[model samples]
Target chain A: MRRAKFKAAAVAFIASATLASATLASAPAQAEIASGAVLANTCFSCHGTDGKSAGDMPTIAGKSEDFITRKLKAFKSGELEATIMNRIAKGFTDEEIAALAKFFSRR
Target chain B: MTELTRRGFNKGLGATTALGALSLSGIAPATAAGKAQVVVVGGGFGGATAAKYIKRFDPKIGVTLVEPSKRFVTCPFSNTVIGGLNTIDYITHGYDALKGLGVEVVHDSAAAVDGAKKQVRLAGGGSIGFDRCIVAPGVDFRWEAIEGLDAGTAARIPHAWKAGAQTLLLRKQLEAMADGGVFVISPPVNPFRCPPGPGERISLVASYFKTAKPRSKIIVLDPKEKFSKEGLFKEGWAALYPGMIEYRNLAEDGLVRRVDPASRTLYTDFGEETGDVVNFIPAQKAGKIAQVSGLADKTEWCPIHPRSFESTLQPGVHVIGDASIAAPMPKSAFTASTQAKVCAEAVVNLLRGAAPGAPKFINVCYSLVGENYGISVAMVYGYRDGRIVKIEGSGGLSPSGATPEFRRKEADYTRGWYESISRDIWG
Candidate 1:
């Protein structure tokens, strides 16, 4: 039992140490996606996490970046006939919409 | 369980190995300089989502979630359970997925938080230390605010606010009530959880009464002059159950003063009234732990930094959900979960010695006028001048008069919202 405990503790320590180092190395890459992730995160509450819809709401994940950008802009400009998307689209800036489009496209 | 196992293992190991492991793992005695430790209190929409997102944001961070229940019954869509439109099992969620994300799920309630020591004292006896704490302890009723209404008396008169046994109790009460009987709901004043909750409850109960007991009537004694989606609800009420529901405003003596649960009587300023079934939602404040820990101010809500949601009173602690004084953001599940994601990112950035990004929030509340008929109000918010303010001309209520098809579509989206949000938070 004592040997097992020692082994387990050692494994946990090594695992955590490796994870800490991995996080440090990936910091810059994570920052690149951070803004898009933050903006696209809100849409996950109704749209599923990562822009995949679990229900009637259309899934935005895996769509083309151009498709998303165009649809959101159309919704924002009131050219797209929608129920609630038009209202939500009106809140985002062009930059934010682009970030969201990029984030979901890459999902 | 991970922490507990580590603690037990450390006790049996030699001093050198234990010390080496502790330093390497960054477990306990101090923040130690390696992995970040975050202790989240409460496991509802706010804390659970924060816990999950924090790990998602940075898997290296150690997250310990403290909650009392093994499974959580959600407040949203709970009205459907009372109205017999859905089952309790459908609305309840488990924390297994959060555990699967490598979060330490501690099934213990938090008794108090020691801000100075940076530790949370648990009711189960041991204390858990943290680099930062996220408190999402929703709301608790001011039991003293109403006479003859305490936790014990609340058993007879169900508030059903927290959505568990009380939900089932209210449903059974409605089932037991005779035909043509009066169903009374007394909604409290502003800044309460789910401002539109009372209206939705009234609408759903009326839906049940309209079908099960057609002659049964509902009496809504609202303290507020006007309510959320008032015109939509009024229009729907007229179209569906006209004259079946009567609403009394504050000027008409709608505020409830005291309740006699034994007799099912409520005493308003005007006179006394009795109901076969009574749901007296009393005045509320921050959750019990937040109130007792000096996190809430005189207004009974925690003040927070609009950008990071860090409690103004407690520097290293973040407060989210209904307990937070996030005006222009009504207390709803969507807002709480969204706030959780924002607070999670902020906590991660703060730990990494980086500034939190600016955040924008969205809330779309859909209430069922009937199972097929729904009305909604949506708002988008941005941080401005030390407050969360709604963007101008961005959000408004659903069109006043709509086709039946529109209402039905909104209702469909309501179910979709619940499923998607539930998955996002706990799935």
Candidate 2:
């Protein structure tokens, strides 16, 4: 009985999402907003969820967007001393850095 | 039968609802609403993180994580457990936190995946359907590759590869041995789980022997010529446990053709060596489910789309972690969790009929040369023209000439990483 309901729900969701995507596909701006959320998620592995640190790693959440962008750029440029951040910072583009910074700063 | 594409899906959206009627032929619970379902197989670093991130990305999507084990013992710090610096409990995690996150946790092994039918047949019986599926079964040992080593005989030799009981067994074996006894550690060939694992294990076990059993020695029969953090590990061994560790690379006749578990002996190409305790990590491939489900190809690993980790062979199915052929990105807890997030986001996007976003992945692996000594290798990966490649000038090993204090700080950070990553994924 439970299995049948799950199947029904899954089909409905795909149907709704299909209709929803018609709208999302037309709007490039909405794609960016969603993209930013996922790009910043990669950081949670080390930096903690939503950029909050649970241990010795520094808390990236609650920081200013400008602070994040500047620090990341410095790390990328090798202007800042880092253990692992320098390598990670180099992987992101200026735009991605901005998105990540914006994502974390809001938290 | 009708085909479905993003461009033409709108026309067939009506057929999707009619398909729901086809599903009503079977029994289904009333609570299952019109939420898209994602079934995640295996609850290790990959599956757990994928489940969490999928919900994080879209709470409306229903997620059911299928794992056989109730508790997850991380491979990351299992070396510390063997070294006596930590206990198994420190590295062990429960699924309660994941359960608290509104994920439907199913304690069952996945028996088969019917991709065309969009259903996962469980070993416990019954089937769960999914709009998308994520398989993160980690790695299973290739017992046939090594003579005298199979699941039944593993207890005597103890791979300790999967942690939990095996970890305790290996630790107990080491503890039972006398001070002057020899410990033999043999690492399998390339593309095994956790590239830095054996190196770290050798270092930690040496650290253990250095204190409690000063006369004890370690013999490493490595199949590969070199390993991750090779320079750092070699330097640390020379400085800390000089003359206590002997490393024999493949070219030096370190290949073990067979194991004599009854005698605790390893038969290498040159000669057979007996030890008080033997740790043999056998050659590995994607977990059994991957092969049975048709996710793995001739390589015995799943090939995935570079951008989304979706299986190239099976659409709507994403394979991540040790099960996938993601070279340049070594199989570690960090990479598994990182891949999980990328896959989760991709799955969410696909379910929503939106294209997956451009992905960025990072991997940081820290190995303890001793209790207060640590070294790390890190990389930030990006999608290139057709594959995942290391971002140039982005990541590398720790400085070879670092001061003791720097090493100690890195060791501290190792603990911090374990805590934060655990919280992020299962917390």
Each prediction's TM-score against the native? Answer: 0.89, 0.89
**Which residue ranges in model 1 land beyond 4 Å of their true spot?**
A1-33, B1-32
Q: Candidate 2, B283: how far from true, in Å?
A: 0.5
RMSD of 2: 8.5
Give the runs in model 2 whose Cα sits over 4 Å from its true position.
A1-33, B1-33
| Tens-place lDDT digits, model 2, residues B285-337 | 99999999999999899998765687878766789999998888998889999
lDDT of 1 by residue, A22-100 (tens): 2332221123226668778989998999988999888999999889999999998999967788888888776667778
TM-score of chain B of each: 0.92, 0.92
State the lDDT at B87 in candidate 1: 97
Q: List the residue pairs that clash in candidate 1.
A: none
Worst-scoring 10-residue span by lDDT in model 2 chain A: A24-33
In angstroms, the error of model 1 at B346 is 0.4
lDDT of 2: 0.82
State the lDDT at B220 in candidate 1. 82
lDDT of 1 by residue, B1-427 (tens): 1323232222222232224324543453222367889999999999999999999998889999999999999999999999999999999999999999999999999999866577899999999988789999999998898998998877899999889999999999999999999999998888889888888999999999999999999988887888888999999999999999999989888888889999999998988789999999988899999988889999999998766788878767889999999988999888998999989987776565444555689999989989999888898887655568887767788898899999999999999999899998899
